[model samples]
Target: MWSVVLLWLSCVPAGLQAAAVYRRDVPHQKVEVYSVTLDCTVTSRFAHTVMTSKALNKANSSQEIFFDVDLPKTAFITNFSMEIDGQLYVGNVKEKEKAKKQYDKAVSSGQTAGLVKASGRKMEKFSVSVNIAALSSVVFTLTYEELLQRKLGHYEILTRVKPQQLVQEFKIVVNIFEPQGLAFVEAEASFLTNDLLLLVDKTVTDKKAHISFTPTLEQQRTCPGCEGSIIDGDFIIKYDVKREKSLGEIQISNGYFVHFFAPPDLPRVPVNVVFVIDRSGSMSGIKMQQTKEALKAIFDDLHEEDHFALIIFDNKIIKWRKYLSKATQQNITAAQSFVKRIKDNGSTDVNSALQEAVKMLKNGHRKNTIPERSTDMIILLTDGNPNSGESSIPVIQKNIQAAIAGNMSLFCLGFGNDVDYSFLDVMARENLGLARRIFEGSDAGLQVQQLQSPLLLPGNLA
Candidate 1:
């Protein structure tokens, strides 16, 4: 018998340290940020997600502040602006080198050099120093796109909230319009939801959806005597269009649109995939057993047109085939036998394993031009830190980046808390991919299947 344990980890830092900047004109007493006002507008037409955060300063002086905004990895921002005292300063996208120069100039000139950077784990941190003019507030707004995703026959959007301190006021309003008739709408939150209001148009003719969720910490019994309510976690919304068919649905109203693409009828683009498995000593027990079961099950789902390869690594690299092979029944049976024979023993040689996977994909691409139109992916599963050949993360990431060379996507699965998930996340981000952490106690095989099922394409709006 095998027992699995599920570990819930904090995805965000405990708190942000926004130290006060001292100056002659600055107030001697520390300024407290009393309230944070958040307004978000998500649309499906262009699939844009725009958000504005206003921070009010209580003390009568300038204050320095920093906050991290966590968004989906698919999001890309094109506009960033700050509004202060009825004046707006907008920032334009510039080359990395030019942007650095401009930022430096603003700082040296005693101007507000607000910085926005993509931190690890799908979060962006914004830092700015401004004079609030004694009890005033500064508003920062960023506009981005690619917040809509499709899963399990529905469209989904996620909004994260993790303010270390409770603000006086925090409100979030979302307006959605679907032409296919507002079929179904639902919201899920880890915090209290009694304060949230969902107003839907009963008349099918309206074809619109609106959701407003506000958290009230004062009424919470979990943390009593705390001025603000404990609000920390994600606010997720999932909705489905009423239409029965898999054909996508779109809705337009007042020059704005939201689309739900669920094309189950369309033939999936053929895929050439490589499953890179780790057989290090740490994975010797239930981990290895679950992995083998997962691989065998996945092989059964491969279409005839799709091709696959299997490579398991420890101290040395092992390949199931010299080149990619068809997903024929006989071949799949042979692969299952190969997977069953893989016993964990040696140390982890991630560097070599990744290189070999990329090499195989590149060679396969060169030999078969048809797969160029298809998607090439490497699903790497690792459970231990690299201890053999080229162990440094930077070196391994660089080599893998060079080998893939923007041609293929890499999906990483870190098994359990023992693996370095940060490394996987960064590498996947750089390679136009994503990494998922698989908990041990749960259905490990099911998680693997979920990650690979229906394979999301690059820039896929679903």
Candidate 2:
């Protein structure tokens, strides 16, 4: 009988231990309570979550419990601590933004959205601790937000995620939607792919999305026999996409389009050109007259931002203006008048002319020293060879090189065959510029055309 009593006493302790554990039952989920009652919304644009309840129940009643709540995936609760009836529960609460199925449909249909959209999740939870209690309730809240889609015209998209609790594994899914009858132009998920230009036919679809098309070289329809005829044409184009992803179906009816045109965008660089003209005896008649006309045309082509200085070289380099000035009507007229007054001189000292031009450019560089507007250029025109004062090719080349290194572009114009083409070529090549050989007759205008062509081309040399 005594042995039986001892066994009963041992069983009593086990029963008491089980009875000591307590759990509190909450009717509503903690997230629901916080969102509805406390009016707390997740503020993160991405996925985020927070727990709203931190209570314990030590009652001795056994009961069923239910958790309910409407939680967004963008909640911003940084940390969460919870205990049920003095016992911490090992669990987690989370929220996530759902991806749209329409996006995937759009990609398949060839109506891809230019912007990239991503998805994210945030969650917080705790383990239940052992303590005195009855029935207990554990409440959690989850929220998440989808990543933004890539912007229109952007070639690539990237997304990232961080979970509140460390997880063993995870999976992500992206769907892309395409317009009906839309063809895949090109796509790249990894950064290691070459970007390809895509062209869409205007007749293929009536969608209003941006399109890219290779510019077609239209036929030179203008009469080739006509003098001074400028030929030009454009190529038809449609929308273009460089990268690819399976984010979701994109809708074509939504007007997500791509467009392109010929010759791409061209960047214009401001120019500060000094016109150094030779008015020596050789440039007296037709040469001088043609030079005046060419100068006028050049002045007309000057952009409002371009700066110019006119210098006439004969017995000496005479600056019509002491400094560079805007190509305004007043300044252009003044320059033209000065050119008209110039008379045929006795000698052609090209070296002195060049030195004076360099001096002007150097002074200008030191004055209005803006960062990108520092480009300087010299357009040197001559009919006769260098006649005096350091006239050797080597000496001239050395001076030209120094000016170029100081950010000056040199263009040499050889009027008539009497002018040395060899020297002109060397000067131009050294500065990555151009050299034009003008014939004696009416075709001299061709030299001006040649000079203007290089100026229009896109490059730092211009």
Candidate 3:
């Protein structure tokens, strides 16, 4: 029971919301947010969420407004649009470079420029500013979609709502479709807020699910000129479907189909794991301590069939083992000790360190005498940008690409807000994996364990 409690306490939802206020050239200008609306639709295999925020100018002069919002790393944005001075501007998804070029072109052509781009794992930081005439309003809308990833026999969907400022009107609606029938469904908010009113459709069916809620703020009786609302956390929903005994399930809707495959009782396969850590000076305090703790926990949980290596980098790189070693009792203990002794001091060399990790994995894959098919993966933990060696992001990206050549998957864990999450996100996507941001205040070990689940793909269930 205690272990269960600890696990739940450690593994809370991993969404962090940061707010950036628009700076007005003329100080003391007032900007009032009028409303915020959220719509989410979920199917057995996928979910789509959209947010629209409307704000109006309260100052006598024209006002400029900007909004920065974050989203989960797994989400793929589908659309972004804005209404300025009664004109609507919709942004189309394009290649990152192409999108940038389009945005630049719009600005140069004296048109309303709008852009939506991914900044980090499960997070999209978007900022758009337009000059609004006095007493005028602007509405900005963003839509994104993500796979309803399955875990522990259920499907999960998560959405974040944080409009830094309290609005006059706020609402959210969720629609879920599950032709397989829902065994159960649950929705919850992270904090207590009277503003959130959940609405459920009376026409309930085994295949249909729906929920709607509104978050608002009320004048605080205790404090003058203050408001009360839970505007900081995530809105999460999870449900399990009644499955017919089969190796997989498929759902079809409106000419689109989704397949869910879960192989049964697959034996564990051996895996080669490499830990690439960044020990820059910026990671000297609590960040380093938590990293060590996470590493220690990972070490203690390793299976004997697994082979592992550790590579730490700052201005220089150090390898715990020249080659991968079996995760025996002795080796695990040694690895734990090595993790305990890691100290932070130098500048970061992200490019070279990652290259070294991939090289080690490649060499191990070719030379290992083990007969079982072992998956090769590199877990990179960093807290800073590449500054010491091969500092250019593009150079580092191309170099790592050439080194791995699609031989191994790279998963990155960005330590704190100081790290370049965009860099990590891009690198992971290129290598057939993903990146995650470890909020400095959360349990780093839990985040590490979350990523560990992907290691247990049905084909490599260990």
Top model number, TM-score: 3
TM-score of each: 0.51, 0.42, 0.58
lDDT by residue for model 3 over 1-462, one digit each (tens)? Answer: 000000001111122111122242333238877788888887775788898898888888766677555666556567777776576666654433344465555445444444334444345555556666777777888888876656776777776776655678877788888767778877776753453423322234788888776544552111335653446677777787776556566777789555665455666667788899888897887679878867876776678888889999999999998988989999998988888889998898988888888878777756754324777888888874888978988788888878878877888888864568888888887886788766554456755666666653425321
Off by over 4 Å in 2: 1-263, 369-374, 456-462
- lDDT pick, better of 1 and 3: 3
**Alpha carbon lDDT of each predicted model:** 0.65, 0.45, 0.68
lDDT of 2 by residue, 393-453 (tens): 8788887787568467788877753568798888877885667655443334433653674
Collision count of model 1: 9
The numbered model that scores best in lDDT is: 3
Residue 414's lDDT within candidate 3 is 82
Candidate 1, run of 10 with poorest lDDT: 3-12
Candidate 3 regions exceeding 4 Å error are 1-39, 43-152, 156-172, 177-199, 202-208, 212-237, 241-260, 369-371, 456-462
How do the candidates rank by TM-score, highest first?
Answer: 3, 1, 2
In terms of TM-score, how similar is model 1 to the real structure? 0.51
Off by over 4 Å in 1: 1-152, 155-238, 241-267, 369-372, 454-461
